[model samples]
Target: MTLRRAWVAVAIAAVLAFPWAAGSYVNYVTCLALTYSLVTLSLNWVTGYAGQITLGQGGFFAVGAYLTAAAVVHAGWPLPAAILLSAVATGALGLLLGVPALRLQGHYLALATLFFSLAVPEAIMALPSLTGGANGINVPPSTTFFGLHLSNLRDAYYVLIALVTLVVLVDRTMLRSKLGRAFLAIRDSETAAASVGIPIEVYKVTAFTASGVIAGLAGGLYGSIAGYLNPATFDLWLSIYFFAALIVGGLGNVYGAVIGGILVVALPQLFSQAQNLANILYGAILVVVLLTLPGGVADWPRLSRAVRWLWHPR
Candidate 1:
């Protein structure tokens, strides 16, 4: 295999082996990292791939999580069934929202999604009967997977790994297909893409719907792992965090999503000594990277080339 392919294989192997290689704390952290990576990858479908900037991802995530929790607790549905329903429902809502909202571009669309993100939780809160009000709802015991129950940290880590692997595989496959090409074309130029026989509106809505499904899946998986659901957990800041992860990782690449996702989730834990200091440090790092390396970590090859030229004085 080529160097890139070799690196990809190594990364996958390491991710798969993390539960066995790490302690309880590390395994927990890895699980969180995998979850964030899944969300980031989903965000990339619209933000990175389709060139749509949405600030409502947290809303969709919350919807999925709450739906899963509600279905299991109130409706007495099975875990897998609840999760599937959440994905479908959220994806449908996303398509409905995208159909009308996709007409706008840049900041307008962003503002529209922002409204959705900010309003969703409050709306849930207002409906005391359905959403358990502001107190949030508790998740029930998790279901068994195969023959193993995911109650322990080690078992939970394995479940996250499996889900993340499936998501990443789907992302890779989609990016190599016609739909992926349509996304790229739309991102490049809508007019140009439309002129070439691409159905711009259909594809845009589809991308948003796909992004919703990914977010839903990630959210359901998260709810299962945490065994709890809270409106605050899916607040607007969460969307900002995911967006920051994408910007830091390299928006258009899957590897970048994974790397960025891990860093975004790990940074707060790693620098929890002083909250303000951590934010300052994190913001500084982001600014420095954006100014010096616009393409994020995934563009390391170009960065390396620049370093080599500077050293050689060529």
Candidate 2:
């Protein structure tokens, strides 16, 4: 355990030094990757840990982005307060949706969430006065963080790193608690969990609510980073990409979220020359990963060892 902790510490230190080691462009990209990592981690809580399939994560994400932007742009709220309120609002929305729809299992639940993903952007367009409709809204640069104004990607990277670290710690603590065990129980077998006195309905709703809060937080951070908000930004493809990240990284594994986030953000840039074909390539990669590594890219070490043993017959 000590060795493992040491390795984790080393890895974190490396991540912290990445922006300085790399060029400005790389720093920008890493900032975006870190934001996506937060989103993936949030998705992991509900889909990976609790076995809930939600396609409306984009909607929740947008809720956070737009709410924060509106609060900051119109209401003149401070950045931190806007972000916090956006997360809380999104969590409440998640609870409202989860209470009734979570009872629907399998495809039914997915379809319900899919509709939600479809609805959010339309709702934004319908309310043109606030959301700016198709024209999009411009977010002001965040200034005055505890009396220190941030002015560059490097500063934002530090804030993101701190946020991600807090998320990791909270996530680890939650999964180790009895509440997390109940989530796993519901995921594995809802009926059996209920029979064993696990409040299935309550836990499922709580999981969804928690997931929304995290996604909303990520969205708020993203808006601050991008300094723009649009209905198109949180489309169906975005939700699909989040799901793909979860599968590719390895569901139910924390490390998988990190791996998935880096790939999702980096892959498109790598294929920028063939922008039209990026989605096709992403789909192909996802299929290959699912077929060859059901446990995700996180299982590559074990897979490699097994293959080597097979070949050498040791």
Candidate 3:
């Protein structure tokens, strides 16, 4: 078979075998990995591909989670409708927020987005009646589809995997399309891209909207996973973590997004099990990776070629 066909077969087998081979605990980790992967992909569209530096992605994710939880737990909406509505509302807010804020770049943009992210949970804290205030709110039981309920972690795992796969596939396709080229153009030189007739504002706004929509979707799934929502869960620190994950994984590469997602979620859990030692180790590894492998793990192909050349004798 051709390389492409071989890869397709490998992917199919992996998907088919994953759930059955993994135990409940492993499945739970997988669930978190998938959820975060979705968020990373969305963030990548702007941060990695479009060269936008945003730290408020966590705010959008939190909005989606909180909105979904409120709609289902309190307002009694079905999960599907709630998810869609949350995405739309969050996308609208992202567009609204991105418009004025996109005018700033570098430190100014970062600070603005950082402030937005920091404010999100605090705003929830201040709204006791609607958001349950500081103590947070419990998520409702998982949704049912065609008489099958998805309340357990195992079931939620499958849902997340499905969503992550869908989003990744769609994003990979889009990144190879004309719009993706537009995004890169805007990234490299917006002025030159506009000079050649690209719609700079439109692409920038679209990237923000897309990022918000995916973040919201991921947040909705994550709320269900956590089984509760707290103001602290979506704080500015979480945004920092997300950015760190992206940088460590690789920029402008979908595979890097997946690796980064797993590292961000699972590595922390592994650290938690080791008390303070895990943090020291994690920090050490991060420093080493940043210094030695600045291009990220996803750049292994390029690194391999370089190593081969370096060892080759003239």
Candidate 4:
């Protein structure tokens, strides 16, 4: 198998082995990495494959998380049911929002999403009864997902891995289908795609909806993982972080999406010393990656060539 195919499996294997090799804290960190990777892959569906930019992913995430938590806590919904329904509902919301915003291309759409990211927090705060205001909802340990109780970190890790695998498979399948082709066509040139009779607006809206589903799934899983839900967690900065993670992982690449997702969670832990320095370091890493490896850390072959060229300059 090609590195492209093997990298994801390798990552999964490494994570699976991590619980045995590392301590509980390390295992927990790995679980967090796997969880965030879903968010990165969700953006991969939007900015990477669909060629549309979104700055409101954090808002979608917030909705999914809160909705999932509320369903379980108040409505007495099962964990899997809550996640699935929240994802579908979020996707519907995405469709509604995308209709008007998709008409505006480039920076305009981005600004619209940015506003969405900012607005969600206030909306959460406004709906005190439903959202728990600033205090947020604490997710009870889910015991109803196919009778598999998530009582320990290991159990959660397994569930998270299953979700990640599902997302990756769906992503890869779509990437190879006609729908994926339409997204690429629209991304490359809207006029060109329209000339071929592709419904640009419909596809764009679908892309946004699909992106929302991914984020919603990730968000629901994240809420369960953290055992908490609050609007503050899904801030504008988190959206920026998601975008940065996508770039660092390599756009239009599934393996890169997972790798980038891992880094977003891992980076903070590595720089846990100063805390403030982590942001600076992340900015520096992003700048360096942008300048040097536009394909991101997962683009190993390109990096190898660069390394060789540097060593054997003509």
TM-score of each: 0.88, 0.90, 0.89, 0.89
CA lDDT, every model vs. true structure:
0.80, 0.82, 0.79, 0.82
In the range 70-160, model 4's lDDT, one tens digit per residue, is 8888898998899998899899988998899867878888899899999999999998888899988788875456666554677778888
lDDT of 2 by residue, 103-185 (tens): 68888888899899999999999988888999999888754344433336787788888887788778777888998788888
For residues 1-314, write the lDDT of model 3, one tens digit per residue.
Answer: 36555666676688767878888778778888888888888889878878889898889899999988888887888877777888998899889877986688878888998999988998899887767888888876656523334457667766777777788778778888999888888888878898999988788888888889999988877777777788977878678767777877877777778778787788778867674675565577678768977877777788545434433324
Please give the lDDT score at residue 292 for candidate 4.
85
Q: Candidate 1 has which clashing residue pairs, if any?
A: none
Q: How well does candidate 4 match the true structure in TM-score terms? A: 0.89
Best by TM-score: 2
Per model, state how many residue pairs clash.
0, 0, 0, 0
Better of 1 and 4 by lDDT: 4
Off by over 4 Å in 3: 2-11, 145-148, 274-286, 302-314
Ranking by lDDT: 2, 4, 1, 3
Candidates 1 and 2, the one with greater TM-score: 2
Regarding lDDT, does 1 or 2 come out ahead?
A: 2
Residue 165 in model 1: lDDT: 69
